[model samples]
Target: MGREELVRRVSEFAKESEETILNQVRKMGSSLDWSRYAYTLDEKRASAVSHAFVNMYEAGLIYRGHRIVNWDPKGQTTISDDEVVYEEENGKFYYFQYGPFVIGTARPETKFGDKYVVINPNDTRYKEYEHGQQIELEWINGPITATVIMDEASDPEIGSGVMTITPWHSVVDFELAEKHDLDKEQIIDKYGKLLPIAQEFEGMKITEAREKIVEKLNKKGLLVKVDEKYTHNVSKSERTGATVEPQIMEQWFVAVDKPFKIPHSEIKGVKSGDEVTLKQLMRTAVESRDIEMSQNGFRKTYFHWIDNLHDWCISRQIWFGHRIPVWYKGEDIYCGNDAPDGEGWEQDPDVLDTWFSSALWTFSTLGWPEKTKDMETFHPNAFMSPAYEILPLWVSRMILMSSFHLGQVPFKKVLIHGLVRDKSGRKFSKSLGNGIDPLDLVSEYGADAVRMGLLVGTAIGNDINFDESKVKGYKHFANKLWNITRFILENHHEGVPKTLPDKAIGYLDELKHIVAEITTEMEKYHLYLASEKLYHYIWHRVADQILEETKEVFASDEEDAKIAMSHTLNIILTTSLKLLHPFMPFVTETIWQELPQKDEDMLMIAKWPHTKD
Candidate 1:
């Protein structure tokens, strides 16, 4: 399909998918305000994204440069480092003779791009090969001259204590080439085929070229040996499942290490006039404890990523994202919120990376770049809960963008959660045919039961091995709660009393203690602990003990004892419904509607019961 047709179709599909997702969220009882909902591609969000890009560009933090980036050959786009998935695979390590030196490499196909042979400066084995010594390498393609460079970064322990530099194909070699001002050659095309420099191997795929080149090298007596059991990590694109090729490309990037004056900042020890880099802004947000993580160990992971941060490639060769708000009129370039007045300018064909727009989600959803009530009230969100896998991809970028634009962290605290896997600890996937549809479970068991089952035993930042039995158990728990409520309502008096009678005072006190404990657990973000406590208290204490005792009291002929029993039952039923509303909203709300005494129109807005009350 053409680019325009593809974009139109994708946009329609996105809208339909979004509506389907929103309907599911409503069916699952989410409390989000539909009136304030916003999409990343909406006009307001697109404006906010363009405004952010222009501002950052003017601040010198965003630049267009040629640098090595993760290139997804299948997607035909440049992806960020976070989008690359590394997998360990068995491969062969080939040792090839290069004139006087023998070097080891896993990829013989990239040898055509080798520009330098680097050796450790302290390695006595290559001491005779002085720095800048010229030597002719008997390459499979033909004879090529390479300079011997001495550098301490080269490992003397690996391979033959020497390594060939393929600057355009490797990140380390690119950095080394920049450090030593060495030349770079491009031997791999964007389609992963050999370039014209490979001669007979030209136009061959990288895999095919590797086999053919090895055979040629062995025929030429240049192949030393090969290790068949060599295992190494290969980077693959997360989106297309294609091997990621590190290539030099001119793309728009966010300069993470470039210092820019803080336009505004709300973080402690950081002021508007202070100068800091994007890396520092993200690091300070977590390091200063302004944004606490759910799991303390993830803080170390966040710091390690920031310490080794690289310039972010924010451009993508895709048709379905926010088009970069940049125009070119021959040599003249213009970047702004809107297109320039001239008719001769053509806008950039590529779009900005998806994360570039998502980074502005917290504030942009509240009408950023335009002063508004929502921005003032909700810009600094209180909390954010996302999967731990995106700690660097989405979370860190949100912090960096918020700090730069709004001068504060996006949220005060982040609760890192984990993926839900099958019972055998395998991730849910279509190919595996093990994916569980929550809607199907909600259909079998009530929505409240499914919600309770998910939260009952799951801890923060821990993967859930979802068991259908847990949902079945919670389904039974819901039935028990409904039956208990029915019995209490059937036996209770018409009007709720102002205070409990003396005989019911003990039950009231015990209820107060349980409420206090559950409230404390919930405040600490211990949802699992709170759910477990509520499950036990309601099943064992209320239904088993209190109801049995109340039954005897109701059977008495004494009028005062009966009234006290009915009043205590009413209080316990109402209080428990309120406590359980968060976990089992649908069932609790249904029960709340049947009660005679209710303070709010909806149970969601009902005042929480206090221990003193």
Candidate 2:
């Protein structure tokens, strides 16, 4: 399909999917402000993206550079390193005779681009070869000259203790080339076909070329030996499932290690005049306790990622995103929010990476780039709850962008939740046909039941093995709660007394302790513990014990005892509903509206119950 038509169709599909998601959220009774809803592709967000690009470019943090990237050949786009999925696969390791050294490589197809033979400097086997010594190597295409270089990155324990450097096809090779200023040759095209440099193997697929080249190398007496049981991790594109090709491409990148002056002094010890790199800013945000994670292990993960950070590739070869705000007219190239003030200036065809816009979500959604009330109030969001899979992709980029622009972390605390898998502990996928439709679950049991079932036994940062039996059980709990509310309303007297009766004082005190414990768990971001506590307290303690005991008081003739019993029931029901509201909002709110003594019009906005000292 044509690019424009494809973008149009994809956009329509995206809008429909977005509306379906919003409807499901509303059905689940989420208390989000619909009026302030913003889309990444909306005009305001587009403006924010463009503004950010221009600002970063002006600050020299964003630049066009030739660097190695994970290129998705099927998608015809450059994806970030985090988007690459590595899977262990069995392959052959071929050892080839190169002049005096025998080098090992798994990809003989990429050998056509070999620019250097790398060896460990400490390896005595290669001591005769001095650094920068030119050597003639036998090749399928004929004689090729390669320089010998010694570096510790080459493992002396590996096969042959030496390797050929294919700079255009490998990250380590590219880094070595950059360090030594060596030449790079591109042997693979964007279409994954061998380039003309491969001679007779030109235009052949990489797999086809590998077989053909290996056969020709064996005939030329250059192939040493092949280990058929070589197993290694191969990088593949998460979206297209194609093996990712490491290619050097000219793309826009955010220089994460480039130092820049802090624009704001809101972050502690990071004054406005202080200079820091994006990596430093992100590390400081967590190390200084400015941003706390729900799990301590996630903090370590965040720091490890930051310490090994690379310049971010921010451009994509896609049509349905914010087009890069760069224009070029002949020799004049401009990076700005708008096109150059002249004719014949064509804007860059590539769009910014999807995550580039998503990274600006916190501030851009609040009308950033222009001082606004929402930005001032919500720039440093108090809490962020996102799936753990995005800790490096979406979460880290958000931190990097926010620290650079706002000079503060995006959120004070991040609760990293895990994915919900099938009951068998396998990830739900289309191939497995194990994906559960949450809306169907909501229709079958109810939103509240499904919500509570999801939270009941799930721990922080742990994957949930969803079981429909749990939802069915929670559905029964909802019905029980409804029955308890009905019994309380039917048996209670006219007024809710200020104090608990002496007989029910013990229940009141127990409820107070449970409330305090639940509050503490919620404060620590332990939603699972909070949900379990609420379930047990409402079902066993209140329904089985207190409600059954109060029946005796209702049957008595003393009006004051019945009144005190009713007051105590009222406090228990209202407090329990408030505690459960976050997990089971719909049912709790519905039951709250039926109660005669509620302080707020909406149960969602009611004051959280607290324990008195």
Alpha-carbon RMSD, each predicted model: 1.6, 1.7
Clashes of each: 2, 0
Q: What is the C-alpha local distance difference test score of candidate 2?
A: 0.89
Off by over 4 Å in 1: 494-503
Model 1: per-residue Cα lDDT at residue 40: 95
Q: Cα lDDT of all candidates, in order? A: 0.89, 0.89
lDDT of 1 by residue, 190-260 (tens): 99999998889999999978878999999999999999999999999988999999999999999999987
| C-alpha RMSD in Å of predicted model 2 compared with the true structure | 1.7
For residues 1-613, what per-residue lDDT tens digits would candidate 2 score against the true structure?
Answer: 8978989999999999999989888887788888999999999999999999999999999999899998999999999988999999999999889877788888999988786888889999878888988987677678888888889989989877888888998998899999999889899999999999988888999988787899999999999999999999999999899999999999999999998888786775577989898898888887887888748888888888888888999999988899999998888889988777979999899999899999999999988999999888887999998998899999999998898888878999898999999999999999899988789999999999999989988988899999999999999999999999999999879865667667688878988999999999998888999999999989998899888888888999988888888888888999999999999998999998898888898998888999982
Clashes of 2: 0
* Candidate 1, residue 576: lDDT: 93
